[model samples]
Target chain A: MARITREEVERIADLARLTLSAEEAQALTHDLDTMLEYVQALDGLDTQNVEPTAHPLPVATALRPDRARPSLAPEEAVGNAPEREGSAFTVPKVIEGVES
Target chain B: MAQRLGTLSELRAALDDGRTSASDVVAQALGRARELAPAFAATRGLRADRAAEEALQADQRRTARALRSVLDGIPLLLKDNLNHRGEPTTCASRILDGYVSPYDATAVERVKAAGGVVIGRTNMDEFAMGSSTENACDQPTRNPWDPTRVPGGSSGGSAAAVAAGIVPVALGSDTGGSVRQPASFCGVVGIKPTYGRVSRYGLVAFASSLDQVGVFSRTAADAAALLQVISGHDPLDSTSLDEPVPDYAAALDGDVAGLTIGLPREYFVEQGVDPDVLERVRDAVKELERAGAKTCEVSLPHTPYAVATYYLIAMAEASSNLARYDGVRYGHRATGAHDLQSMYSRTRSEGFGAEVKRRILLGTYVLSAGYYDAYYRKAQQARTLLRGDFEAAYRSCDLILTPTAPEVAFALGERSADPLQMYLSDIFTVSANLAGIPGISVPCGFARDLPVGLQLLGPALGESLLLRVADAYQRRTDWHTKTPPEAS
Candidate 1:
């Protein structure tokens, strides 16, 4: 296992969409390094030809009827939104250059 | 002493015989909860007025002799992770600070339909991530037995409430020993049903594959009553099993004669286990043997790898599941963000606690480029071998008995400083979640005056057998009957 560095911690935090302070990044680098070291015990075990068990039960994805019945009203759907315009949620511009 | 609020069956009989009104029962429970709240910090949100109205309706139904089920008129607390309509489902995380659920979790709906009163929501670790309630956004819940020590978590509040005799039962989500370990620490009965046995539709997902809503109660029979109410298939939860649901309470006859119970040597004689906890569990096995149940030693050779495998898999799933909590649609949003990207990053950084953020970062790292095959995939493959180990062991024994936790509850901040040490606390209980089996932790005896739980694990969809064995052991012991001094 490779040692986790502060730069690596910052990169992982970026991928996770979380912003870390310099102090937090330094601390997490140490924590993740230790955790990775602990989990490296799996490297000794030979899992050759073994399939991964994602879900315990062997169930296929359940599909529902295509027809729409009762569903949440638009306002109810966005009821907990921090900002909303009319019946839809207001975000900070997904397509920055384009105007609606 | 004030008359103890009895178990579900006793409360039901009281309502049926007109000895006590449901209104009075709810009032009594709310009062007791309020009295103990300052000391234990068990409850986060209490629906006192709504609970009173529900109790009135229950009392009217009792007069008309039209009861919904055994849970009718019983007051129970829900772990904060469960969504109840119009109530905040915080999962004890600031990210969900002011969000109110628009609909009930399937388990909550079933409990309400069965006439169980939703008295309040209990405290837990933030996003069910920690072994102690200290991770909660609210103040940590202390053990009812010893105020200086923690009531094991992320279901700490529910366990504390039940141990304090404020409620007969409560619902909790157990991703990895959240329910069972707390119950063990607090001297109560907690049941984590087979992964698909109970629907997880409205539960705030922690680790999708590992998370299962479970029950905490004073007795195995009460846990069974609550489990039966919540267990079944739900179309909303695709992973829910379509198997036939059993009357779990009816199956609890306390008969263990001629049954084979496997004592997993890995857990009992393990190096990290406290001698006192091991001794009490061994004594409980002997007592069960005297009651005609056979005991045999079994080995789950891959037991040591359970913690490592569980954290990797669970953190990966948590990272994916928690991606939905971006700032736009719901939950807490960050301020002064000029762009969309900054909005997400700042919102998450501000909203999540240290532990939740750590897991998310670690999870992202493991699933990122180059490390996926080495960490995530390997953990999953090892999980298969661990599951196989359980299957091989169960072939010879009806149920596996082990200590729920390696030791009794420690002081509140003892293990909080070290995350790896905190993670190891769930060592004995994580395997059942990994293997998707049902396990119950019942109070066996005391270790240094604090309670120790004896864990009984059964194969998939084997809740009835697990309950039967636990109920049998409970019938021969009075450990569950010993209430905390503060509660008494």
Candidate 2:
């Protein structure tokens, strides 16, 4: 049986950067277990020599001429930013000890 | 007044013959949209002034005898996931609160260039995640046929709007049956072109590989009209195919003679599917047969594993694609965070609903260390076999026919509590997405007073053939003409 423990659920949630309440975590643990069990049906298929198909259609990288083009203005780009200073998007500090 | 506006072609004729003005049609459609938006929660926002301006431009074009295309002055709705410049595109999620798009998606840009006025943006499952529209941060979109039931989602609002007769056509994105299922539920025609047929430049990414922009219309010909306007290669989206787009409407000669359609035996079985839905689909096939199309039985033995494979791939891609919504760039950002980590976690948890969180968690679990081979890799391999099934089946058949969904629209809260049950609702439609083929759902008949959809799938770049068959069937049946009484 494909099973997910509460600890495993919390770990996955952390990796995904999601904050879950204890109740939501427990419920998710059960739901994940149920879904995992369902997807286990893929084990029945004999895909020993089959190649994994990541894209439905074959894709080729499109190339364009290296020419200067007008891009989104700084003001236009940052128009939707919730926290902005001038034309830059403001964010919480990343370094351990950094001055604002 | 709302019900009087016919299909896109009819509207085009009306414009050409000076029987009606673009302003009159757009005004009437927008009026209906405003009147019905509250009851069905079908529209997230309306673009009254922009639509009026566009209509005025179209009228000027008509006066100068310089119409842009058949879609000139035609009013349509866009799913909220598509970015329209200077408009709020929330995708019915709290995360994108107050975020106005700085540019238009390629499809939106094309429609505007063709003089198609945007009446509004429709509601959808946040990030197009669920089978029903109930997963929205805003009010759930209810089925116009029966207000208590759901309009199948995640393009539920687009389907509902078209089915409600507010607009003749709309644009939606289909990843694992979002467009077709809702179109089936709402008794409209929805088309998911080949995976790379339409450019995905400004579409909010849910699952990158599986996502494709689709269209919902009142008829196959109307779908053809809109699909033609928006399809073709775009340099912005590298994944878009560069092949020439055929004349979709012209290909619909209303002739199905000499066509051989394959019916997958696995899908027609009595188990798990509503017997009534199967019957209606069978009857639809019989009608096509009567019109001289040949039928044969084919086996896509891998059909049973499609839903599982679809969810794995879709969620994995969604997890990766949705990582951009961190508190840094744009969208919702939590305040008073001591660290960047807390800001991200708090912003996402506060912004996303329960379903989005669940998918992200499960997606992360599958792609994480020690489990990638067992889950994500295996699903990708399974996807190969699924595609192979279609490739082999197409050898002897021109197209494949199946029921678009397992059942008609169920009550609003019926499957919300159970994610697995909700996933199963996409059984018949996801295979087309997995194989990267084209599929169209047309209204067939009714079960329990709700619309049933008949799905026709074709090989990659086979949109012309699929539309031909769909238009032929629509010509023989009047089901597509029936609108929900709720609109009246």
TM-score of the second chain for every model: 0.99, 0.99
DockQ for each candidate? 0.85, 0.87
Among all windows of 10 consecutive residues in model 2 chain A, the one with the lowest summed lDDT is A91-100
Q: What is the lDDT of residue A4 in candidate 2?
A: 89
- Report the CAPRI category for model 2: high
lDDT of each: 0.92, 0.93
DockQ of 2: 0.87
Model 1, span B381-457: residue lDDT tens = 99999999999999999999999999999998999779999999999999999999999999999988899999999
lDDT of 2 by residue, A1-100 (tens): 5388999999999999999999999889989999999999998888898899999999877789999999999999888889989999887888988787
Error of 1 at B139 (Å): 1.0
Worst 10 residues of 1 chain B by lDDT: B1-10
- Clashing pairs in model 1, backbone N/Cα/C closer than 3 A: none
Q: Which stretches of candidate 1 lie over 4 Å from their true place?
A: A97-100, B1-4
**C-alpha positional error of residue B56 in candidate 1 after TM-score superposition, expressed in Å:** 0.3
